[model samples]
Target: MANGVLRPGAVFAGYRIERVLGVGGMGTVYLAAHPRLPRQIALKLLHQNLTSDDYVRSRFELEAEHAARLEHPNVVAVEDRGRDGGQLWIAMRYVAGIDAEKLLSEGPLEPARAVYIITETAEALDYAHELGVLHRDVKPANILLERRGSNRRERVLLADFGIAKALEETTQLTSSGMMVASLPYAAPEAFDNLDPDPRMDVYALGCTLFRLLTGRQPYPGSTLPQLWYGHAQAPIPQPSAVRDGLPVGFDDVILRALAKKPNDRFRSCGELADAAVAALTPVSQLVVPPEPEPQAAPAPEEPTTVEVRTRPVATTPPPSPKERDARLAIASVTTRLSAVQTRAERLEPAFASLKSEFSAQCSADLISNERISSAEIVEAETILTSAVEALDRGDAERALELTRAVRAHLSTAERNVDAVTGRLALLRAVRANPKAKVAEVRFKVHDAQMLALNHGTADQWQAEFDAQLERIDRIAAELSGRHPDYWAYITGLDDVKSHISALVQRMKRERRLR
Candidate 1:
């Protein structure tokens, strides 16, 4: 439903898709589970349209082959592999934590922390190398850190060896004809060599370490050729260059690993880990001193004294009835918003099914992601928390206004979540019956399209929906050429495409009126 993906309830090869973990260079990876097993796993599936590409399909198979041989605790384990309809998929061991990119977004990791993760990942790399598996794609997003366990230690897992094969083989291409990897993290030599080895991974790990320590990629290039020049010819920058007061020892370790020549880098993973332990060791923890007290302003050179004189002035009365009623209405809405937020927060821990439903119906939807900002939501929640504190301190007017502001923010998200539910339900139904009548399916698509437009999805979602439709059209073309038997399926795709296009045009008109 979300860009032609399987619904949460849809099962493929016995694994039920729960939610999307992320979209990767190769495909979308979803959190899934076995129908009878207690454990959850990750399901990596190729996009439905990309299934016909030989290069992409071969790369997927290569990933499966590469990952199946890796059995280390630090590397994500492959549980199963199969083809589901037009998509090829691999079920993997589920690591319950966010990726390094999400973590780094909050801020840079401390030297000690970054070193620990790097070391753990190095161990995984060493293990995979020993097994003759080459993971050329080593980046922050590929490195997953499991939630802290009872021991307060995190477990790290490396992911997506599939992309290592595909991107290195395929030149970046697009309608513009100059598209490149948004942030390619492969080693410098891999760009030309196209062969993987331990040293290649070591170089990538070094670059990943730089990002972890400083919260950004080493080279700030925006274009593919610029990035290529950066990796191949630009001088390697140290981690401490970006982060002040960081241990200087890291300069030696990082620079040597990022040396233009592979032979200049660390000879082995063991050697790299030994150097990291020293480079990452804390000479002293950074203890922030307390904020200084504000000093009173000094008196001017020419001292002036004001003469005390009481003057009669017209006095304003208290708020009139209309003003008072406006305040009361805001207060009432504030209370309602507070109750709704309470219910939402409760879903995080109090109810499992409802929490899952929200993630499925709202969080998993691509439209919701493009329309909403998670950071903004968090900020609004924090403001509401402060507003509640203001109420606790008996500042009724200030609390009422602040809470009302937060209510509007929450309402936007609440509306988005509610609006998608009906549309998504229809999408799920249509996928289940691809052979259904044109009129029957068109009705379902029409209903969903109307709901999307009413909820303001036309202008905001047209570009994304258009791209998805193009993919469907491509798939239809490929399918139609095969035989007469696929004509019905192509017709099904046509109905979906036509309905979506109508919705888009309707949205454009709506936007113009506004």
Candidate 2:
């Protein structure tokens, strides 16, 4: 192995490693060719250090076993797992596209598109939950999006069962002081160290939806303490509050999903996804309006009989062609005016919201080009005014043309406003606390190291490893402090963690030889 990475042409357990797919705290995943088959598989190898630890090894094997039992279309399949040259490995179906986490780098997905991905993930979660399996770690990174065909529509699949547990299993992997779920998306109960359940996954899934909708984590806390505090105490944030133009109903859906109590949340992941779909759907589209009731006939008037008209009542002439044409034009314009009025009324709220958000966003100094949206709104309003004046003047052709222009202008304005809102929201989030995520990821690294320290059963080198861990702890604290560039510290922490993992592996090998 080259620096713990299998080199190209290196065969292990009948699989030939082609290249590294991804590296995690526990292991490295590779795109490997199956010996007996013509297909490629994502082969994940447990770090040599982790394989020497009983708990970590058991958890690795459990991921394959638990995932292999789930046969969901939206769930990634586990092919097999076994030991190869003393390193534990798992083979799974190789998905071709990026995960949802990477997709969010392009910014929040369209509401419909985000909901579609969530819906697919929900089905996969419910499937596993039904089979007595709980994917304790349900975050965007674990949800793979496979874009297919010419249209590039994504096929969403829920993956990474590394921390999943059977319902009947009593083992608590957190015994090692490492949280099974990612901190940003972990449920409140997870911090409480409560028993594992499906609701925990539901809570994580809700957090995922929030991230997808806002391009920000639900809680932007800079420390592990602050993160858990936000989950347990901070009020659930409304998506519309983050990004303007989001449906108000989405707030309710996310609120329920992130409910402090599991029972207070959706009964299942499917229900959560259903609620998201419902939130995206308009109330006007949900049901038909009732027909108006017929008016009751007035009681017959009595004793008011009128005398017959006198003879020689003059006959009236039929309308002239010009008169008829004018009447028809008036009627046609009146109908068009009604339609346009209704359309404008429907858009009025959106325009008002844009105006309000633009005002609020200006104070933040985050959106520099908000003037474009402001000008668009003003121009659209001016066009609408011109359209109304033309209708009042009975210039039907001019009115029709101006009304179409108003609609087109409003359409462009709305699109621009949405773009502005997204940019404003992203900037605001970054300004507030970019280090929260770095803190969260660093906590994971530290937690994993602590877990390893707790499991290092060999006594000869334990004292030396403890001193190294203390040094790492000091370095981790410094990294979490006032760092000018957060990514620099993050990169530093990753290097530190990788070095520690390598040392642990070396210690295990030396102890075994002795």
Candidate 3:
């Protein structure tokens, strides 16, 4: 279907094409197997009609270069690229599973599975954002699910970069009057031709999560224009309203992410992922959600003490009206001061508890690691301090407002901690195991190398890591190290390290480790 040639078993670039996997609007994807290596790959070739256009060829090359730089478990890996005769082709990892849209069509996934997919995708998006790449078109169709092994279910891999925009690039792929279309997953700003950002990806992710839970797109319409209108004017319906047995906080998280204004949405994909995880967790296990307003019952209608002091009243009234007004003002100020002191007394313990929690949750490595910076911690602390001050001033309403901000910041900090801590623990385990198999050791070493590069300064860290990684490559070059097809797992680590090296360099310069 690609070119009315290159059929199954046909050789292209020394790889035999097995069959056509699928045809998209812009290209045809084929299932290809390498001749010498016992591995299968998906080769995507640009449509023949567009090969002659220099603009299309440039955009295709740009996509391959950008996609090749991304190396995350949740992202589909772009392996190699070349021109096959008149057609341009990109070799990508061939995943034997369905895309997310197809998986959703059968029914809603288990709640835990859905959360896992969403969280993993969020991490991938966070990494991409740090490299200044925005996957402007994020939807179920663009997400591929890869099966690992027997009983391993499937892993989510984000795909499609046809419309992705690189923040550093001045040229755009889409024409001036053309509209870049995605399904219901497009954010409000996406429709307005605004440059996409991390928040825009967060908004699309929210829409995707909503669809996963409810088995329906949030804003379904007959036409793209109709959907755009709905996105602009319609309120996001609660998840529970569409389906029963939804989690309590699910609706709120989705609504917040789908906020009309970019500023109203979560600041980053990590924030959205953290909130989604918390929502999916059982209510009994979660810290209770904060109560915004707590009005005290009308203090039992305190009895009025009406002691009739007739002589005192007459003496006071004899004074000038101006003197009486001044006295009233003084009394008001005294009462306000008393209230402030009382509030301070009540909030002292709460402030202490908050500080203790912050210190206990954020470790030194978390603070120093590139994943979560000191600026985020300072922002959270500042907001929490303001909340305490507000409470001390008897402004409970304003205090509650600041508390919400504090909670959002804390959520992001917790996620960054979790991500970095998990990676650190894995590395430590690998380092401690003297009897670790070569495959396992290689995997750990590769991960460690990536972490080092990602957290390193922008000067020569990449070059240093590259030199160290070459040792692994040299080991694979030995004749005695060759192994059977089944034992070829060790070589896979080399491939992973090569890709991750590129990813680390891209991310470190952009400051998007999280």
Clashes of each: 0, 0, 0
TM-score of 2: 0.54
Displacement of residue 509 (Cα, Å) in model 3 is 33
lDDT of 3: 0.60
Q: If both were scored by lDDT, which would come out higher, candidate 2 or candidate 3? A: 2
Which stretches of model 2 miss by more than 4 angstroms? 162-181, 283-514
User: In candidate 2, what are the lDDT values of residues 1-514, reduced to their tens digit?
Assistant: 8787889999988899999988865568999998998999999886676456555555556556656777889988988987765778878899999998888999999999999999999999987765556787788888998869787777999876744332112233343234434778988888765555678989999999999999999999756687789999999897977997776557757877898877667667987897688678553343221223445545455545664433453444554443333333333233323333443343435444434643443333324334544565567557656655654455556654654465444444434444444334433443355544344334434434544454554355456556655655665456445433333344454565566556555644564486
Q: Tell how far residue 391 is off in model 3, in angstroms.
A: 24
lDDT of each: 0.61, 0.65, 0.60
In candidate 3, what are the lDDT values of residues 1-514, reduced to their tens digit? 3446568878888789999888864568889997778999988776666456443455556656766778888888888887766778888888889888888979877667777888888988987765545687777877888878898867888886533442112122232112243647778776655534578889899998888888888897956677777777798877766887776467657877888887667667877777777677554443332223444433244446864432322221243343322222222222322322333343334333323433323233344433342344557667756755655454656655665565455445444443444333333333343223344335434443434543454354556456545655554444243322212333344455555546544544465445
For residues 112-156, what per-residue lDDT tens digits would candidate 1 score against the true structure? 788888999999887776554667667898889999778888888
**Candidate 3 RMSD computed on C-alpha atoms after optimal superposition onto the true structure:** 16.2
lDDT of 1 at 389: 62
Model 2, residue 12: displacement in angstroms? Answer: 1.9
Residue 237 of candidate 1: its Cα lDDT? 91
